[model samples]
Target: MPDYQIRTLDDADIAAADALFLGTLHLPPTAAEQLDNLRPSYVPGRALGAFDGDELVGTAMSYPSALAVPGGAVPRMGAVSRIGVRADHTRRGILTALQRRQLSSLVEQGDVIATLRASEATIYGRFGYGVAERVRSITVNPSTAEIRPDLPRVGRTRLIDAAEAETLLPALYEQIGLRRPGMMTRPAGLWGIWRVRETKLDGLARTAVHTNADGVADGFVTYRAVKSGGFRAELRVEDLHGATPTAIRELWRFLIGLDLTAVIKAGSQPLDDPLEWSLVDRRAVGVDGVTDSTWLRLLDVSAALAARSYGDAEPVVIELVDDLLPANTGRYRVGADGARRTEATADLVMGVAALGALYLGDVAPSTLAENGLITWSGEPGQAALGRADRLFRTPTPPYCGTFF
Candidate 1:
């Protein structure tokens, strides 16, 4: 028999669950007012708790959102967050149990995928999650940076107050839409949590919006300034989204022109951001580091495979091994036409985690095979690996800039 029981949490159980989660992070309990502000963001029937008799020992929850896959298909995805287990319960199966239960629940609700920003690198792979996207942390010397003379300056940017941000930002974000693979639609529940964190908890963030020549809002950025010393400060960009290249350039131009800021730092920026090319002096931007951002798990393998468009390549049969979701363990034929289950022999074999990494086209099949994450069904050759690589290749590197 198991030592703990897992069940969905109710309104009355939220406080205990929150406290248990906080304890695992070595953080203090949430204050009454902050908790009150955060309570409604929890979607009913989504949060789960593992109970050791009457004690809440583990907690996990997800927000309902849609992920933009390649070829402009938006599929339902569960944005998982706040997963934790009590420190005393280490080495036990409580964390595994919670993950299994949560994944099963998400599958039953018809979610095609699940994703999370991992707090640690080693925790989630066994649960079938894979690092799907990567981001770079960049620091710019604003004083030395200059926008190139040839870059278009078609848009105008203006700062907005917090109250205006609360109303205008969401609408502008929706208008911008998900133009890139791995981006996600922010639902009301997720937005509520961000609002609480920005306004109630931190209260230091600011916003700026960009408008096209016709005076339509097309992009926005949120950031906070921190004093570095001696009257100089560093501006940290929290979030930035743009609908067009011109809008993105204009927004950066506005930020570079801000007063009293010595440097600007932005995290989780896409690998293909044109900021460097737009600058007259490319070395003005310094790359601090690159890190994993979004980790993805394919809940429905067939549906996910068919949703994204593929590059031109001959068909290749891939045999998937899904231990947690046994129904997905089978051979699939993937090509430019689409993907479907096949009875023919597979050319290559991989596990679900490998599939997740390959799904977004961030990592090529050849790279995964070289890393020992994939194997050949027969004798290994470059033909199959090259075909798979071309089939899954994307024009731009996949990036998920949102931090849940």
Candidate 2:
């Protein structure tokens, strides 16, 4: 038998769990004051700890939230975070146990999906988590970049103090709603941590709200200006969202117009960000990097498949292999109409991780098949793959701007 016992953590165990999690990352211990501020974000019984005898050796926790899928379906999801195994307990099956328990709890609690920002790309795939969304880090030379004259400017942006930002930003975000697939509704628990980070941890971060001619708030951005060297200041955009393209353009105009700013940088931006095209010189904006943003796991296969809308394509049967959750290992026929379980022969075969990747409509089935992540079970494999690709295709690429 294993030495560690997995159990639900209580409020009193929050500090130890947090410390253990931080220690695994080689970070400093959490300050008493900061821990107190973040305590409420840790919901009671949401955290799970692996105890060896009486010491906490592993930790994993998630916050309640909802994810927006294609066709405007918002299903319950768990925003998983703080997953770590103590140094001494590395590769001892502690983390796997914690994940098993956590995933089971999420399923039992009726969360249709679970999402997490993976610290390492390679760690979560074995646990059935797939890279569902990708984001780009961009650096724009504001001095050389100029907004195109053809783009309409119909909004004004105003800077707000931290106090006002604390109150207005959340409401503004809700008003804008989730316009893209993979976007999630932030709960108060998650917002509490974000608030502390922006307001308390980052002193340089500032907020700006955009309003149209009607004087109604429609968009917002939070950024910080940091001195890189002599006479050069880099404006790092932390969060930016807009209800309309005009509002986004105006916000960019304001940032570009900031005096004495040398460069503007933003991470976790959507792959299809319009800022580049809006610029008079498209090359003025450089791609710094592209990285995975959201690792998604579909806790319920049938429900998740039916949740998102599909494109017009012939029906294709897909056999999903889910080892951890055996109940999901079955054949499912997916088409534009909807998804349902069927005993028909599967044309395409893939694991649950590949399904998660395909579910967001971010990556195409043929692409996954080409990459050897998927295999064919029936004849005319290319045709079946093409059908699957068209069936899961989305107009806009999936993007999850929220970082948890």
Candidate 3:
């Protein structure tokens, strides 16, 4: 094992961290240039790098943000991004050391939880990060899809230029509120990257705003069109947000009404999209795929458990094993009242990472138990697991619309 020191990143280290991050993915420098243009989200004294005698081999960056959980409580969370290890440093324990240092720093800084979008599914479990949220992609044949008359359509949508969108969208998102459990408040750096500087979406995408009956901007969808042939066109959605059910319906109406567009594709949509039910022909909406989005790690187990609301079920004692953050290893009694450390024997045993996976109510405890990710103290523990599942379940499956 190489002796490497993990420390906070500074202004002088940005270029080096960016280079190694891009280099690890085998991407060109153009990507780094694109990253440079966006406002840096790195929190001072939180961005960490593992250096082997001053040569940077690994980097992980974090920023402060509030993560919305059940019962409408938003807790301060650490949002980690651009985590990577130099190609040659793989399997050498450098990644582990960097994560440990980052998690430790977050705990000291009073962050209750840490979250990241994992590039690979298998990479972060050992570090106590769990898949806390999921998103799905949908393909709609717009020409055949029809909105049912019963669904209220009180809003009128109109196209807006990029500059106008830049001014309105951020405020619209705030007005709409981060109402979902897994949703987050987007920082200025992320908004600048997505709405202002056209990187992945590029400059071709157009923004459409939905106005209420009183002519107020409430929802918007950013999408782009591509002509594949003389008669065929496709509309790809870049981003979409709605403040109300009527706003959502109106926005979809506008998207489907666009002429020459046969196929409409959108990703990162909530699992319970009303567009499916709004259609006259339900089969027109095809679910292309679903993938994990937000990976959460509870930096402070006691605080994390107490932050979110639970169901009106009987309390259950859980024994959590945290390999990286050993201080979190203990039994906790969690229920509708809130969670607290308890000296009683645990009804269930799970890894800290597994607990994080269930923190946002994305996956149920019973489901994890069926998959052997959880261990019960008794043979027929279905009742206890059922109660725990209800306590952790949310009205909608957790979905994080914000990328960072």
Model 1 segments more than 4 A misplaced: 199-203, 377-381
Tens digit of per-residue lDDT, candidate 1, span 116-188 = 9998999999999999999999999998898998876886898899889978888888899998999998877
Off by over 4 Å in 2: 199-203, 229-231
Instruction: Give the root-mean-square deviation of each candidate in angstroms.
Output: 1.6, 1.6, 2.2
What are the TM-scores, per candidate, against the unseen true structure?
0.96, 0.96, 0.93
lDDT for 347 (candidate 2): 91
How many backbone collisions does model 1 have?
Answer: 0
